[model samples]
Target: MGQLVRGVWTADADFPRDADGRFDRAASQFRDMHVEPVAGRYHLYVSLACPWAHRTLVARALLGLEHAIDVSIVEPVWQDNGWQFSDRYPDRLHGARYLWELYVRARADFTGRVTVPVLWDRERDTIVNNESAEILRLLHTAFAPLARTPRDLVPEPHRADIDAINARVYEAVNNGVYKCGFAGTQAAYDEAEAALFAALDELDATLAGRTWLVGDALTEADIRLFPTLVRFDAVYNIHFKCSRKRLVDYPNLLSHTVRMYRLPGVADTVDFDHIKRHYYLCHRSLNPRGIIPVTGQGAYLRLA
Candidate 1:
Protein backbone atom coordinates (compact mmCIF):
# COMPACT_ATOMS: atom_id res chain seq x y z
CA MET A 1 0.00 0.00 0.00
CA GLY A 2 3.10 2.26 -0.13
CA GLN A 3 5.87 3.37 -2.53
CA LEU A 4 8.83 5.67 -2.88
CA VAL A 5 7.74 9.32 -2.50
CA ARG A 6 10.97 10.80 -3.82
CA GLY A 7 14.31 9.03 -4.16
CA VAL A 8 13.80 7.65 -0.66
CA TRP A 9 11.65 4.65 0.21
CA THR A 10 8.54 5.54 2.23
CA ALA A 11 5.51 3.66 3.50
CA ASP A 12 4.00 6.81 5.01
CA ALA A 13 1.64 7.30 2.05
CA ASP A 14 -1.39 5.32 0.84
CA PHE A 15 -2.19 3.29 -2.27
CA PRO A 16 -3.46 5.35 -5.20
CA ARG A 17 -7.18 4.60 -5.34
CA ASP A 18 -9.70 6.36 -7.51
CA ALA A 19 -12.77 8.18 -6.12
CA ASP A 20 -14.91 5.18 -7.00
CA GLY A 21 -12.74 3.06 -4.65
CA ARG A 22 -11.01 1.31 -7.55
CA PHE A 23 -7.29 0.68 -7.31
CA ASP A 24 -5.34 2.51 -10.01
CA ARG A 25 -1.93 1.07 -10.75
CA ALA A 26 1.08 3.28 -11.37
CA ALA A 27 2.69 3.16 -14.80
CA SER A 28 6.24 1.76 -15.05
CA GLN A 29 8.82 4.57 -14.78
CA PHE A 30 11.92 3.07 -16.41
CA ARG A 31 11.85 3.14 -20.23
CA ASP A 32 14.13 3.62 -23.29
CA MET A 33 15.07 -0.04 -23.00
CA HIS A 34 17.68 -1.35 -25.43
CA VAL A 35 19.92 -4.20 -24.44
CA GLU A 36 23.07 -5.68 -25.97
CA PRO A 37 22.60 -9.40 -25.63
CA VAL A 38 25.72 -11.24 -24.54
CA ALA A 39 26.62 -13.82 -21.94
CA GLY A 40 26.94 -12.43 -18.42
CA ARG A 41 25.95 -8.96 -19.65
CA TYR A 42 22.33 -8.96 -18.42
CA HIS A 43 20.46 -10.36 -15.40
CA LEU A 44 16.87 -10.70 -14.25
CA TYR A 45 15.50 -9.96 -10.78
CA VAL A 46 12.21 -11.70 -10.14
CA SER A 47 9.89 -13.09 -7.47
CA LEU A 48 8.43 -16.53 -7.99
CA ALA A 49 5.13 -15.29 -6.52
CA CYS A 50 4.69 -12.45 -8.98
CA PRO A 51 2.64 -13.30 -12.07
CA TRP A 52 4.04 -10.44 -14.12
CA ALA A 53 7.56 -11.52 -13.29
CA HIS A 54 6.53 -15.09 -14.03
CA ARG A 55 5.79 -14.06 -17.65
CA THR A 56 9.42 -13.15 -18.33
CA LEU A 57 10.61 -16.41 -16.76
CA VAL A 58 8.32 -18.34 -19.09
CA ALA A 59 9.75 -16.57 -22.11
CA ARG A 60 13.27 -17.08 -20.83
CA ALA A 61 12.66 -20.79 -20.41
CA LEU A 62 10.68 -21.17 -23.63
CA LEU A 63 13.29 -19.29 -25.65
CA GLY A 64 16.21 -21.13 -24.05
CA LEU A 65 17.88 -18.01 -22.59
CA GLU A 66 18.98 -19.75 -19.39
CA HIS A 67 22.66 -19.54 -20.28
CA ALA A 68 22.53 -16.14 -21.99
CA ILE A 69 20.57 -14.15 -19.39
CA ASP A 70 20.99 -15.09 -15.74
CA VAL A 71 18.31 -14.51 -13.08
CA SER A 72 18.01 -14.08 -9.30
CA ILE A 73 14.83 -14.84 -7.37
CA VAL A 74 13.67 -12.90 -4.33
CA GLU A 75 11.65 -14.17 -1.40
CA PRO A 76 7.90 -14.51 -1.98
CA VAL A 77 6.82 -12.13 0.75
CA TRP A 78 7.15 -8.36 0.52
CA GLN A 79 8.03 -6.59 3.74
CA ASP A 80 8.16 -2.92 4.83
CA ASN A 81 11.55 -2.92 3.07
CA GLY A 82 10.02 -4.31 -0.13
CA TRP A 83 11.26 -7.53 -1.83
CA GLN A 84 14.39 -8.88 -0.17
CA PHE A 85 16.63 -11.79 -1.03
CA SER A 86 16.44 -14.85 1.22
CA ASP A 87 18.92 -17.52 2.24
CA ARG A 88 17.48 -19.61 -0.58
CA TYR A 89 17.83 -16.72 -3.08
CA PRO A 90 20.59 -14.49 -1.80
CA ASP A 91 21.74 -11.83 -4.23
CA ARG A 92 24.38 -13.34 -6.49
CA LEU A 93 24.90 -10.21 -8.60
CA HIS A 94 25.33 -7.02 -6.53
CA GLY A 95 24.78 -8.64 -3.14
CA ALA A 96 22.07 -6.09 -2.31
CA ARG A 97 19.93 -7.00 0.67
CA TYR A 98 16.79 -5.37 -0.78
CA LEU A 99 15.41 -5.03 -4.31
CA TRP A 100 15.14 -1.23 -3.83
CA GLU A 101 18.92 -1.09 -3.60
CA LEU A 102 19.08 -2.17 -7.22
CA TYR A 103 16.66 0.61 -8.19
CA VAL A 104 18.64 3.27 -6.37
CA ARG A 105 21.74 1.76 -7.92
CA ALA A 106 20.14 2.02 -11.36
CA ARG A 107 19.18 5.67 -10.81
CA ALA A 108 19.76 7.63 -7.65
CA ASP A 109 16.69 9.79 -8.25
CA PHE A 110 14.36 6.98 -9.38
CA THR A 111 10.80 7.32 -8.10
CA GLY A 112 8.09 4.71 -8.66
CA ARG A 113 7.09 1.20 -7.73
CA VAL A 114 10.05 -1.13 -7.23
CA THR A 115 8.68 -3.87 -9.44
CA VAL A 116 10.18 -7.21 -10.43
CA PRO A 117 10.97 -8.81 -13.77
CA VAL A 118 13.64 -6.12 -14.04
CA LEU A 119 16.12 -6.53 -16.89
CA TRP A 120 19.43 -5.37 -15.47
CA ASP A 121 22.44 -4.55 -17.61
CA ARG A 122 25.46 -5.47 -15.52
CA GLU A 123 27.94 -3.86 -17.90
CA ARG A 124 26.17 -0.49 -17.67
CA ASP A 125 25.12 -1.12 -14.05
CA THR A 126 21.52 -0.02 -14.73
CA ILE A 127 18.14 -1.54 -15.37
CA VAL A 128 17.44 -1.97 -19.07
CA ASN A 129 13.74 -2.54 -18.51
CA ASN A 130 11.26 -3.33 -15.71
CA GLU A 131 8.22 -3.90 -17.85
CA SER A 132 7.48 -7.62 -17.95
CA ALA A 133 5.59 -7.43 -21.25
CA GLU A 134 8.53 -5.74 -22.97
CA ILE A 135 11.09 -7.98 -21.27
CA LEU A 136 9.18 -11.09 -22.38
CA ARG A 137 9.41 -9.91 -26.00
CA LEU A 138 13.09 -9.15 -25.55
CA LEU A 139 13.79 -12.59 -24.15
CA HIS A 140 11.96 -14.03 -27.16
CA THR A 141 14.37 -12.35 -29.61
CA ALA A 142 17.15 -10.39 -27.93
CA PHE A 143 19.35 -13.35 -27.05
CA ALA A 144 18.52 -15.52 -30.04
CA PRO A 145 22.17 -15.85 -31.05
CA LEU A 146 23.00 -17.37 -27.66
CA ALA A 147 19.79 -19.35 -27.23
CA ARG A 148 20.23 -23.11 -27.14
CA THR A 149 16.72 -23.76 -28.49
CA PRO A 150 15.39 -20.57 -30.07
CA ARG A 151 11.65 -20.19 -30.56
CA ASP A 152 9.79 -17.05 -31.65
CA LEU A 153 6.88 -16.84 -29.21
CA VAL A 154 5.78 -13.63 -30.86
CA PRO A 155 5.79 -14.37 -34.57
CA GLU A 156 5.38 -11.58 -37.19
CA PRO A 157 2.16 -12.96 -38.68
CA HIS A 158 0.42 -13.05 -35.29
CA ARG A 159 2.07 -10.04 -33.65
CA ALA A 160 -1.01 -7.87 -34.01
CA ASP A 161 -3.28 -10.64 -32.80
CA ILE A 162 -1.04 -11.24 -29.80
CA ASP A 163 -1.06 -7.55 -28.94
CA ALA A 164 -4.85 -7.35 -29.19
CA ILE A 165 -5.39 -10.36 -26.97
CA ASN A 166 -2.80 -9.16 -24.47
CA ALA A 167 -4.66 -5.86 -24.07
CA ARG A 168 -7.94 -7.64 -23.32
CA VAL A 169 -6.50 -10.32 -21.04
CA TYR A 170 -4.27 -7.90 -19.19
CA GLU A 171 -7.18 -5.66 -18.34
CA ALA A 172 -9.85 -8.20 -17.41
CA VAL A 173 -7.75 -11.05 -16.09
CA ASN A 174 -4.06 -10.48 -15.42
CA ASN A 175 -4.48 -7.15 -13.66
CA GLY A 176 -8.13 -7.76 -12.94
CA VAL A 177 -7.40 -9.92 -9.90
CA TYR A 178 -5.52 -7.05 -8.31
CA LYS A 179 -8.37 -4.70 -9.04
CA CYS A 180 -10.68 -7.09 -7.23
CA GLY A 181 -8.37 -7.54 -4.26
CA PHE A 182 -7.50 -3.87 -3.85
CA ALA A 183 -10.96 -2.44 -4.36
CA GLY A 184 -11.78 -0.07 -1.51
CA THR A 185 -15.53 -0.55 -1.64
CA GLN A 186 -17.99 -3.38 -2.06
CA ALA A 187 -19.27 -1.86 -5.30
CA ALA A 188 -15.76 -1.65 -6.70
CA TYR A 189 -15.04 -5.25 -5.80
CA ASP A 190 -18.31 -6.39 -7.34
CA GLU A 191 -17.63 -4.56 -10.60
CA ALA A 192 -14.08 -5.93 -10.84
CA GLU A 193 -15.19 -9.46 -9.99
CA ALA A 194 -17.86 -9.35 -12.68
CA ALA A 195 -15.44 -8.15 -15.36
CA LEU A 196 -12.85 -10.75 -14.33
CA PHE A 197 -15.24 -13.68 -14.46
CA ALA A 198 -16.68 -12.50 -17.77
CA ALA A 199 -13.21 -12.46 -19.24
CA LEU A 200 -12.46 -15.93 -17.88
CA ASP A 201 -15.73 -17.26 -19.33
CA GLU A 202 -14.92 -15.81 -22.72
CA LEU A 203 -11.41 -17.24 -22.58
CA ASP A 204 -12.75 -20.66 -21.62
CA ALA A 205 -15.10 -20.61 -24.59
CA THR A 206 -12.40 -19.34 -26.95
CA LEU A 207 -9.93 -21.99 -25.83
CA ALA A 208 -12.38 -24.82 -26.52
CA GLY A 209 -11.13 -27.17 -29.24
CA ARG A 210 -7.98 -25.04 -29.58
CA THR A 211 -4.52 -25.76 -28.35
CA TRP A 212 -3.45 -22.11 -28.48
CA LEU A 213 -4.93 -18.62 -28.24
CA VAL A 214 -3.75 -17.28 -31.61
CA GLY A 215 -2.66 -18.98 -34.84
CA ASP A 216 -1.60 -22.62 -34.74
CA ALA A 217 1.25 -21.89 -32.35
CA LEU A 218 1.85 -20.64 -28.83
CA THR A 219 2.53 -16.92 -28.92
CA GLU A 220 2.97 -14.04 -26.48
CA ALA A 221 -0.80 -13.87 -26.06
CA ASP A 222 -0.84 -17.29 -24.45
CA ILE A 223 2.28 -16.50 -22.48
CA ARG A 224 0.67 -13.37 -21.09
CA LEU A 225 -2.45 -15.22 -19.98
CA PHE A 226 -0.90 -18.43 -18.62
CA PRO A 227 0.64 -16.93 -15.50
CA THR A 228 -2.70 -15.55 -14.41
CA LEU A 229 -4.58 -18.72 -15.26
CA VAL A 230 -2.09 -20.98 -13.52
CA ARG A 231 -2.56 -19.00 -10.33
CA PHE A 232 -6.26 -18.26 -10.75
CA ASP A 233 -7.77 -20.97 -8.62
CA ALA A 234 -4.73 -21.23 -6.36
CA VAL A 235 -5.01 -17.67 -5.09
CA TYR A 236 -7.28 -15.38 -7.13
CA ASN A 237 -10.43 -17.42 -6.62
CA ILE A 238 -10.31 -17.20 -2.83
CA HIS A 239 -7.90 -14.42 -2.01
CA PHE A 240 -8.93 -11.77 -4.57
CA LYS A 241 -12.71 -12.31 -4.24
CA CYS A 242 -12.58 -13.55 -7.81
CA SER A 243 -14.81 -16.42 -6.67
CA ARG A 244 -17.64 -16.26 -9.15
CA LYS A 245 -15.97 -19.25 -10.83
CA ARG A 246 -13.11 -21.59 -10.20
CA LEU A 247 -10.81 -22.39 -13.11
CA VAL A 248 -11.89 -25.99 -12.60
CA ASP A 249 -15.43 -24.84 -13.34
CA TYR A 250 -14.26 -23.88 -16.83
CA PRO A 251 -13.14 -27.25 -18.20
CA ASN A 252 -11.48 -25.87 -21.30
CA LEU A 253 -9.73 -23.17 -19.30
CA LEU A 254 -8.64 -25.72 -16.69
CA SER A 255 -7.24 -28.00 -19.36
CA HIS A 256 -5.56 -25.08 -21.08
CA THR A 257 -3.91 -24.13 -17.79
CA VAL A 258 -2.72 -27.68 -17.11
CA ARG A 259 -1.33 -27.99 -20.61
CA MET A 260 0.63 -24.77 -20.28
CA TYR A 261 2.11 -25.84 -16.92
CA ARG A 262 3.08 -29.17 -18.42
CA LEU A 263 5.09 -27.45 -21.13
CA PRO A 264 8.82 -28.02 -20.79
CA GLY A 265 10.27 -25.69 -18.10
CA VAL A 266 6.87 -24.09 -17.50
CA ALA A 267 5.99 -26.29 -14.51
CA ASP A 268 9.26 -25.41 -12.83
CA THR A 269 8.09 -21.79 -12.75
CA VAL A 270 4.76 -22.61 -11.08
CA ASP A 271 5.12 -22.18 -7.32
CA PHE A 272 1.89 -22.27 -5.36
CA ASP A 273 3.76 -22.07 -2.04
CA HIS A 274 5.05 -18.68 -3.01
CA ILE A 275 1.80 -17.72 -4.73
CA LYS A 276 -0.43 -18.54 -1.76
CA ARG A 277 1.85 -17.13 0.93
CA HIS A 278 2.40 -13.90 -0.98
CA TYR A 279 -1.28 -13.10 -1.45
CA TYR A 280 -2.48 -14.27 1.93
CA LEU A 281 0.35 -12.84 3.99
CA CYS A 282 2.13 -9.99 2.17
CA HIS A 283 -0.84 -7.70 1.60
CA ARG A 284 -1.67 -6.70 5.18
CA SER A 285 -4.78 -4.79 4.16
CA LEU A 286 -6.27 -8.01 2.81
CA ASN A 287 -5.14 -10.49 5.44
CA PRO A 288 -4.22 -8.62 8.59
CA ARG A 289 -3.54 -11.75 10.63
CA GLY A 290 -0.95 -12.84 8.04
CA ILE A 291 -2.00 -16.45 8.49
CA ILE A 292 -1.12 -18.73 5.60
CA PRO A 293 -3.86 -20.98 4.29
CA VAL A 294 -3.61 -24.71 3.74
CA THR A 295 -5.09 -24.74 0.23
CA GLY A 296 -3.82 -28.27 -0.70
CA GLN A 297 -2.02 -26.75 -3.71
CA GLY A 298 0.14 -29.81 -4.41
CA ALA A 299 -2.61 -31.51 -6.42
CA TYR A 300 -2.59 -28.47 -8.69
CA LEU A 301 0.91 -29.34 -9.87
CA ARG A 302 0.12 -32.99 -10.42
CA LEU A 303 -2.77 -32.16 -12.77
CA ALA A 304 -2.33 -33.28 -16.34
Candidate 2:
Protein backbone atom coordinates (compact mmCIF):
# COMPACT_ATOMS: atom_id res chain seq x y z
CA MET A 1 0.00 0.00 0.00
CA GLY A 2 3.01 2.30 0.50
CA GLN A 3 6.44 2.62 -1.16
CA LEU A 4 9.55 4.76 -1.34
CA VAL A 5 9.91 7.28 -4.17
CA ARG A 6 13.56 8.06 -4.98
CA GLY A 7 14.66 7.24 -1.42
CA VAL A 8 11.85 9.19 0.26
CA TRP A 9 9.11 7.27 2.01
CA THR A 10 5.49 8.13 1.11
CA ALA A 11 2.23 6.84 2.55
CA ASP A 12 0.26 7.32 -0.66
CA ALA A 13 -1.77 4.42 -2.08
CA ASP A 14 -0.16 3.05 -5.25
CA PHE A 15 -1.61 -0.41 -5.59
CA PRO A 16 -1.42 -1.89 -9.09
CA ARG A 17 -4.85 -3.37 -9.48
CA ASP A 18 -6.63 -4.01 -12.76
CA ALA A 19 -10.25 -3.04 -13.41
CA ASP A 20 -11.17 -6.57 -12.32
CA GLY A 21 -9.67 -5.76 -8.89
CA ARG A 22 -7.00 -8.47 -9.08
CA PHE A 23 -3.80 -7.65 -7.20
CA ASP A 24 -0.53 -7.56 -9.17
CA ARG A 25 2.55 -7.94 -6.99
CA ALA A 26 5.51 -5.69 -7.69
CA ALA A 27 8.85 -7.29 -8.61
CA SER A 28 11.90 -7.05 -6.37
CA GLN A 29 14.30 -4.23 -7.29
CA PHE A 30 17.72 -5.41 -6.04
CA ARG A 31 18.14 -8.30 -8.41
CA ASP A 32 21.41 -7.84 -10.40
CA MET A 33 23.93 -7.40 -7.60
CA HIS A 34 26.34 -10.32 -7.41
CA VAL A 35 26.66 -12.02 -4.03
CA GLU A 36 29.87 -13.91 -3.33
CA PRO A 37 29.68 -16.42 -0.50
CA VAL A 38 31.89 -15.24 2.31
CA ALA A 39 31.47 -16.26 5.92
CA GLY A 40 29.98 -13.52 8.11
CA ARG A 41 30.03 -11.13 5.16
CA TYR A 42 26.31 -11.19 4.41
CA HIS A 43 23.33 -10.87 6.74
CA LEU A 44 19.72 -11.86 6.09
CA TYR A 45 16.79 -9.72 7.21
CA VAL A 46 13.50 -11.52 7.38
CA SER A 47 10.08 -11.69 9.04
CA LEU A 48 8.93 -15.12 10.23
CA ALA A 49 5.37 -14.08 9.34
CA CYS A 50 6.15 -13.63 5.62
CA PRO A 51 5.95 -16.73 3.38
CA TRP A 52 8.41 -15.38 0.83
CA ALA A 53 10.80 -14.52 3.65
CA HIS A 54 10.16 -17.88 5.28
CA ARG A 55 11.52 -19.66 2.19
CA THR A 56 14.94 -18.10 2.70
CA LEU A 57 14.93 -18.82 6.43
CA VAL A 58 14.25 -22.49 5.85
CA ALA A 59 16.83 -22.73 3.09
CA ARG A 60 19.40 -21.06 5.29
CA ALA A 61 18.74 -23.59 8.01
CA LEU A 62 18.56 -26.67 5.78
CA LEU A 63 21.84 -25.80 4.08
CA GLY A 64 23.52 -25.13 7.44
CA LEU A 65 24.29 -21.49 6.57
CA GLU A 66 23.69 -20.26 10.10
CA HIS A 67 27.39 -20.11 10.90
CA ALA A 68 28.28 -18.44 7.58
CA ILE A 69 25.49 -15.88 7.45
CA ASP A 70 23.68 -14.37 10.42
CA VAL A 71 20.04 -13.17 10.41
CA SER A 72 17.89 -10.44 11.96
CA ILE A 73 14.13 -10.58 12.33
CA VAL A 74 11.78 -7.63 12.03
CA GLU A 75 8.72 -7.13 14.19
CA PRO A 76 5.87 -9.31 12.97
CA VAL A 77 3.33 -6.49 12.89
CA TRP A 78 4.14 -3.99 10.17
CA GLN A 79 4.06 -0.31 11.20
CA ASP A 80 3.07 2.84 9.29
CA ASN A 81 6.61 3.07 7.92
CA GLY A 82 6.51 -0.63 7.10
CA TRP A 83 8.48 -3.56 8.72
CA GLN A 84 10.07 -2.11 11.79
CA PHE A 85 12.83 -3.19 14.21
CA SER A 86 11.76 -3.31 17.84
CA ASP A 87 13.81 -3.73 21.00
CA ARG A 88 13.01 -7.43 20.92
CA TYR A 89 14.35 -7.73 17.34
CA PRO A 90 16.49 -4.65 16.84
CA ASP A 91 18.41 -3.85 13.68
CA ARG A 92 21.84 -5.01 14.74
CA LEU A 93 23.44 -3.78 11.51
CA HIS A 94 22.53 -0.10 11.42
CA GLY A 95 20.24 0.39 14.40
CA ALA A 96 17.60 1.56 11.91
CA ARG A 97 14.03 1.59 13.11
CA TYR A 98 12.31 0.46 9.89
CA LEU A 99 13.23 -1.97 7.07
CA TRP A 100 12.92 0.90 4.60
CA GLU A 101 15.82 2.60 6.34
CA LEU A 102 18.09 -0.23 5.19
CA TYR A 103 16.78 0.19 1.65
CA VAL A 104 17.47 3.91 1.70
CA ARG A 105 20.90 3.23 3.14
CA ALA A 106 21.70 0.67 0.40
CA ARG A 107 20.65 2.96 -2.41
CA ALA A 108 19.79 6.56 -1.64
CA ASP A 109 17.91 6.82 -4.97
CA PHE A 110 16.24 3.38 -4.69
CA THR A 111 12.51 3.48 -5.35
CA GLY A 112 10.25 0.49 -4.71
CA ARG A 113 8.42 -1.51 -2.09
CA VAL A 114 10.69 -2.58 0.80
CA THR A 115 10.22 -6.31 1.26
CA VAL A 116 12.21 -9.13 2.86
CA PRO A 117 14.17 -11.60 2.96
CA VAL A 118 16.87 -9.06 2.22
CA LEU A 119 20.39 -10.40 1.59
CA TRP A 120 22.52 -7.54 2.82
CA ASP A 121 26.20 -7.27 1.86
CA ARG A 122 27.62 -5.92 5.05
CA GLU A 123 31.09 -5.22 3.67
CA ARG A 124 29.72 -3.29 0.70
CA ASP A 125 26.71 -1.84 2.52
CA THR A 126 24.26 -2.80 -0.24
CA ILE A 127 21.59 -5.38 -0.89
CA VAL A 128 22.58 -8.43 -2.89
CA ASN A 129 19.06 -9.58 -3.61
CA ASN A 130 15.57 -9.25 -2.11
CA GLU A 131 13.87 -11.90 -4.22
CA SER A 132 13.37 -14.98 -2.04
CA ALA A 133 13.55 -17.43 -4.94
CA GLU A 134 16.88 -15.98 -6.03
CA ILE A 135 18.07 -15.86 -2.44
CA LEU A 136 17.11 -19.50 -2.03
CA ARG A 137 19.21 -20.46 -5.03
CA LEU A 138 22.06 -18.42 -3.65
CA LEU A 139 21.86 -20.31 -0.38
CA HIS A 140 21.65 -23.69 -2.10
CA THR A 141 24.19 -23.24 -4.90
CA ALA A 142 26.53 -20.31 -4.44
CA PHE A 143 26.91 -21.08 -0.77
CA ALA A 144 26.78 -24.84 -1.16
CA PRO A 145 30.52 -25.17 -0.61
CA LEU A 146 30.17 -23.74 2.86
CA ALA A 147 27.26 -25.92 3.92
CA ARG A 148 27.97 -28.29 6.78
CA THR A 149 25.73 -30.94 5.27
CA PRO A 150 26.58 -32.55 1.94
CA ARG A 151 23.29 -31.99 0.17
CA ASP A 152 21.97 -30.57 -3.07
CA LEU A 153 18.40 -29.32 -3.07
CA VAL A 154 18.60 -28.61 -6.79
CA PRO A 155 20.50 -31.60 -8.01
CA GLU A 156 21.52 -31.33 -11.66
CA PRO A 157 19.63 -34.49 -12.75
CA HIS A 158 16.37 -33.26 -11.19
CA ARG A 159 16.83 -29.54 -11.84
CA ALA A 160 14.40 -29.51 -14.72
CA ASP A 161 11.68 -31.31 -12.77
CA ILE A 162 12.27 -29.13 -9.74
CA ASP A 163 11.97 -25.94 -11.77
CA ALA A 164 8.78 -27.16 -13.41
CA ILE A 165 7.14 -27.90 -10.07
CA ASN A 166 8.35 -24.58 -8.67
CA ALA A 167 6.65 -22.70 -11.50
CA ARG A 168 3.31 -24.42 -10.94
CA VAL A 169 3.49 -24.02 -7.16
CA TYR A 170 4.61 -20.39 -7.36
CA GLU A 171 1.63 -19.29 -9.43
CA ALA A 172 -1.06 -21.66 -8.17
CA VAL A 173 -0.06 -22.02 -4.55
CA ASN A 174 2.77 -19.76 -3.37
CA ASN A 175 1.36 -16.54 -4.76
CA GLY A 176 -2.10 -17.93 -5.31
CA VAL A 177 -3.02 -17.70 -1.63
CA TYR A 178 -2.15 -14.02 -1.72
CA LYS A 179 -4.23 -13.55 -4.85
CA CYS A 180 -7.15 -15.11 -2.98
CA GLY A 181 -6.60 -12.95 0.08
CA PHE A 182 -6.13 -9.58 -1.62
CA ALA A 183 -8.75 -9.91 -4.34
CA GLY A 184 -10.77 -6.72 -4.44
CA THR A 185 -13.81 -8.07 -6.28
CA GLN A 186 -16.05 -11.09 -5.94
CA ALA A 187 -15.16 -12.30 -9.43
CA ALA A 188 -11.47 -11.90 -8.67
CA TYR A 189 -11.80 -13.79 -5.41
CA ASP A 190 -13.77 -16.56 -7.11
CA GLU A 191 -11.19 -16.91 -9.85
CA ALA A 192 -8.30 -17.08 -7.40
CA GLU A 193 -10.08 -19.53 -5.09
CA ALA A 194 -10.86 -21.91 -7.92
CA ALA A 195 -7.29 -21.90 -9.23
CA LEU A 196 -5.88 -22.34 -5.72
CA PHE A 197 -7.96 -25.42 -4.82
CA ALA A 198 -7.40 -26.95 -8.22
CA ALA A 199 -3.68 -26.74 -7.70
CA LEU A 200 -4.00 -28.11 -4.19
CA ASP A 201 -6.13 -31.02 -5.42
CA GLU A 202 -3.54 -31.80 -8.08
CA LEU A 203 -0.72 -31.51 -5.55
CA ASP A 204 -2.44 -33.76 -3.05
CA ALA A 205 -2.90 -36.39 -5.72
CA THR A 206 0.75 -36.05 -6.77
CA LEU A 207 1.99 -36.48 -3.19
CA ALA A 208 -0.26 -39.43 -2.43
CA GLY A 209 2.41 -41.82 -3.70
CA ARG A 210 5.66 -39.94 -3.02
CA THR A 211 7.20 -38.36 0.05
CA TRP A 212 8.74 -35.42 -1.82
CA LEU A 213 7.56 -33.11 -4.58
CA VAL A 214 10.25 -33.61 -7.25
CA GLY A 215 12.24 -36.64 -6.16
CA ASP A 216 12.89 -38.99 -3.26
CA ALA A 217 14.90 -36.27 -1.57
CA LEU A 218 13.91 -32.72 -0.64
CA THR A 219 14.27 -30.07 -3.35
CA GLU A 220 13.59 -26.40 -4.01
CA ALA A 221 10.04 -27.21 -5.06
CA ASP A 222 9.28 -28.54 -1.59
CA ILE A 223 10.90 -25.55 0.12
CA ARG A 224 8.90 -23.12 -2.00
CA LEU A 225 5.56 -24.79 -1.29
CA PHE A 226 6.06 -25.54 2.42
CA PRO A 227 5.66 -21.92 3.55
CA THR A 228 2.27 -21.59 1.89
CA LEU A 229 1.02 -24.95 3.21
CA VAL A 230 2.30 -24.25 6.71
CA ARG A 231 0.37 -20.99 6.77
CA PHE A 232 -2.70 -22.20 4.87
CA ASP A 233 -4.60 -23.65 7.83
CA ALA A 234 -3.47 -20.83 10.08
CA VAL A 235 -3.90 -17.65 8.02
CA TYR A 236 -4.89 -18.20 4.40
CA ASN A 237 -7.80 -20.57 5.05
CA ILE A 238 -9.68 -18.10 7.23
CA HIS A 239 -8.18 -14.63 6.81
CA PHE A 240 -7.67 -15.02 3.08
CA LYS A 241 -11.22 -16.25 2.34
CA CYS A 242 -9.81 -19.53 1.10
CA SER A 243 -12.68 -21.33 2.80
CA ARG A 244 -13.27 -24.03 0.19
CA LYS A 245 -11.31 -26.46 2.39
CA ARG A 246 -8.70 -26.26 5.09
CA LEU A 247 -5.23 -27.68 4.40
CA VAL A 248 -5.87 -30.50 6.88
CA ASP A 249 -8.77 -31.61 4.69
CA TYR A 250 -6.18 -32.73 2.11
CA PRO A 251 -4.67 -35.73 3.90
CA ASN A 252 -1.59 -36.05 1.72
CA LEU A 253 -0.79 -32.34 1.81
CA LEU A 254 -1.13 -32.30 5.59
CA SER A 255 1.14 -35.34 5.83
CA HIS A 256 3.74 -33.60 3.68
CA THR A 257 3.54 -30.55 5.96
CA VAL A 258 4.18 -32.58 9.09
CA ARG A 259 7.00 -34.48 7.41
CA MET A 260 8.66 -31.26 6.36
CA TYR A 261 8.08 -29.73 9.81
CA ARG A 262 9.72 -32.72 11.47
CA LEU A 263 12.92 -32.28 9.50
CA PRO A 264 16.10 -31.57 11.49
CA GLY A 265 16.19 -27.76 11.29
CA VAL A 266 12.85 -27.00 9.64
CA ALA A 267 10.87 -27.10 12.88
CA ASP A 268 13.03 -24.40 14.42
CA THR A 269 12.24 -21.97 11.61
CA VAL A 270 8.47 -21.77 12.25
CA ASP A 271 7.06 -19.14 14.61
CA PHE A 272 3.28 -19.26 14.86
CA ASP A 273 3.22 -16.44 17.40
CA HIS A 274 4.75 -14.16 14.80
CA ILE A 275 2.71 -15.78 12.05
CA LYS A 276 -0.69 -15.32 13.79
CA ARG A 277 -0.02 -11.86 15.13
CA HIS A 278 1.08 -10.51 11.77
CA TYR A 279 -1.95 -11.71 9.84
CA TYR A 280 -4.81 -11.24 12.29
CA LEU A 281 -3.64 -7.98 13.82
CA CYS A 282 -1.86 -6.35 10.91
CA HIS A 283 -4.40 -6.65 8.09
CA ARG A 284 -6.96 -4.24 9.55
CA SER A 285 -9.04 -4.27 6.37
CA LEU A 286 -9.53 -8.03 6.61
CA ASN A 287 -9.80 -8.00 10.42
CA PRO A 288 -11.36 -4.74 11.57
CA ARG A 289 -11.22 -5.36 15.31
CA GLY A 290 -7.75 -7.04 15.23
CA ILE A 291 -9.11 -10.19 16.83
CA ILE A 292 -6.74 -13.16 16.37
CA PRO A 293 -8.48 -16.51 16.37
CA VAL A 294 -7.09 -19.08 18.83
CA THR A 295 -7.64 -22.20 16.75
CA GLY A 296 -4.65 -22.43 14.37
CA GLN A 297 -1.60 -22.60 16.62
CA GLY A 298 -2.47 -25.99 18.08
CA ALA A 299 -2.27 -27.60 14.65
CA TYR A 300 1.56 -27.33 14.68
CA LEU A 301 2.03 -29.29 17.91
CA ARG A 302 3.28 -32.21 15.86
CA LEU A 303 6.39 -30.13 15.18
CA ALA A 304 6.92 -29.69 18.94
Which is the leading candidate under lDDT? Answer: 2
Q: Candidate 2: global Cα-lDDT?
A: 0.88
Point to the candidate with the largest TM-score: 2
Per-residue accuracy of model 1 over 196-239 as CA lDDT, tens digit each:
88998888889889999888888888889999988877788878
Q: Taking the tens digit of each residue's C-alpha lDDT, what string does model 2 give over 80-188?
A: 8989999999988888999999999999988989898999998888898999999998898888878887478999999999999999999988988888888889998
lDDT of 1 at 82: 85
Clash count list over all predictions: 0, 0
Look at candidate 2 and give me any clashing residue pairs: none
lDDT of 1: 0.84
The residue ranges of model 2 lying beyond 4 angstroms of the native Cα positions read: 13-15, 300-304
Looking at model 1, which ten-residue stretch has the lowest summed lDDT?
A: 295-304
What CA RMSD would you report for each candidate? Answer: 1.5, 1.4
